[model samples]
Structure formats: C-alpha cells, structure tokens
Target: MENMLQNINSLGLETSLTLDDIPNIDLYMDQVIQLFENNFNDSKRNQEDKILTKTMINNYAKGKLIFPIQNKKYSREHLILMSLIYQLKGALSINDIKVTLSDINQKIINDEIDLDSFYTSYLQLTGQNVIDLKKDMEERVKDVKKEISEAKEEDSGNLEQVLMISSLVHMSNLYRRVAEKLVDELVVDKEGKRQK
Candidate 1:
C-alpha cells in the first residue's frame, strides 16, 4: 500500500510536454497521433488504451470542437486544440469543452490573440498550476499519513485508504466546480451579446 501511494505521488513529475516540444509544422493524422501518444503517454491506464484516434479527431471536427483539417493535414492550431480537449475531456462534458473551445476560437478569429501566443500562455499558466497542485497533493499525502500514524491500531489501515480517496474526490470536485463556473461565464457572456 505504501509503495502504491509512493508511485501515485511520483506519477506526473515526469511526463509533461512543454510548448517547445510541439511541432510547428503541419502533420498527418498518424503523426499527430504519434505526437500525442509520445507526449501524453501517462494518460493511458493500460496497454490497449487509445489516447486519440482518427475517428475521434473526425468527431471533434464534426462536433466543431476543432477546426477542419486542411488538405488532409493538421496544423499546430489543431494540435493545440486537441491537446486542450484531451486535458479537459476527463473532467468536463463534451458540451462544456465545446463552449470553452468555442470561446477560444472566437478570440483567435477576432485576432484577440493568435494560436501560438495563446498556446504559449496556456502552457505557462497551466505548468505553474500543475506545480502548485503537485505540492498540494504532497502535503495532503503527508497529512493523511501523519493522521493515520496517530490513529488507533484497528482503524489506521482503513483510515489511510479512506483519507487518500477522500483527498482525490475533493480535488476532483474542486476542478469540476471551476470548470462549471468557467462554462457558466461563457454562457452568460454569450447571452449578454444576444440581448444587445
């Protein structure tokens, strides 16, 4: 159990890709899949897990979550949009992700910010947040461990497991609430424009 906890703690310390790691050139579907697979390898829970598929990419385009491929090639903008979808899909509904991405796409279309600048800014902000989240998780783990140590003998084992699960649930809830709020903000803004 301790070893399992240690492994969980060490999980995301190694597998993230920075903005510079993303290729600037347009890539074919297979190359795009390979790029995502290599960068977000940790996302797969098992060997058979598919991270991103051609069908899924097509679906995203059809769903308007991503721009349509150009001349059968995906640009860096497509990669960035797909990456955002990958990260958010676990915690957000497809509609919520669509709303968020739509807002971003509108901004890009308006020239409020170009894709490269937006992607760079996103990477910087999210990288720092990930670091902060890691530190918070470590502290939570330590606190849980200390509490478990002080727990009565018969309760310590189950208590440790429960505490870890509770921490994870709490974090998930926090992220979900934030996502919902952002989605709500987008809805409100859209509604405001419609009323004008």
Candidate 2:
C-alpha cells in the first residue's frame, strides 16, 4: 500500500527529448522509426508496444501532421513535430492535433518563428508542469490517507489505492477536457479559420 502510494508521485517522470537529442541530418523512414523506439523506450505501456511505426508515420504524412517532407526523408523539424504529436496524442484527437499544428507549420515554413527556441521553451514548461503535477498528486495522496485514517470502509486496505487511482483519473480527465476546450477555442480549422 505504501509502495503504491509512493509510486504515484513518480507518475509524470517520463523524460523529454532535448533539442540535442534530435539529428540534424535527414532520416529515412526506418531511421525515424528506430530513433523514436530507442529514445522513448520507457514510454511504451506494454512489452509489445511500439512508439512509432512506418504505417503510422505514413498516415501522419498523408494527414499533413508532419508537413514539408523532402525526398522521402524527415528533417529535424519533422522529428520535433512528431515528438510533439506523440506527446499530445493521449489528450487530443488527430484532427485536433492537425488543427493545432496548422499554424505552427505555416509559421515554420514562413520562417516567422524560431522552432528551436519555441521547442526549448516548451520543454522547460513541460518539466515545470511535471514537477507541479507530482507535488499536487503527493498532496492529494497525503490528504486521502489522513481523511480515511479512521474510516471503517469495507476493503479498507485497498480503499486508499482505489481512491488514489480515482483521484488521478478524475484529475487527468478534467485536465484533458480543458486541453480539448482550449484547442477547440484557439486552434484554427483546416481552412485556417478559427471556430469560435
């Protein structure tokens, strides 16, 4: 029980790829697949889980999520974009991701924004978010333990685990709802028009 509670604090500990982690040279499909598999091995949920597949990459290309490929090779920007897509896919649908990316792709293509600086800032924000999330989850766990210390609930031994998982799932769901709302409100449609 203590072990499960302790491990809950480490939920958001997955590391991100720094800019230096991406290759500057173009990558073929095989190399792209290998790179993601190698770098994000811990991100897999199961032993047979694949971080990225050729078919998925092809689908992303067809959907224009990773735009502006050249000579059947993925550039540094493509890898970064793919990484971003992978990170957000859990929360956002493919159409939502494409809509969110549309403006970013245009900005990159027009050289209106610096991708490196933006990506670096995003990484920093993500790191801070993880720290904050762990702190919040830890506090919640402590509160859960204290609140149920004297309760005579059935299956009381596992109540703490059940409560903790419920809290985490509900928190995740609320946050995901907020993200979806923001995407719907702020991201443009395929025709490059805002929905609201």
lDDT of each: 0.80, 0.82
What are the models' TM-scores?
0.86, 0.89
Q: Which is the leading candidate under lDDT?
A: 2
The residue-by-residue lDDT of candidate 1 on 90-143, one tens digit each, is 899888999889977766556675777777787788778767876676778788
All models, RMSD in angstroms: 2.4, 2.7
lDDT of 1 at 140: 81
**Alpha carbon lDDT of residue 137, candidate 2?**
67
Best by TM-score: 2
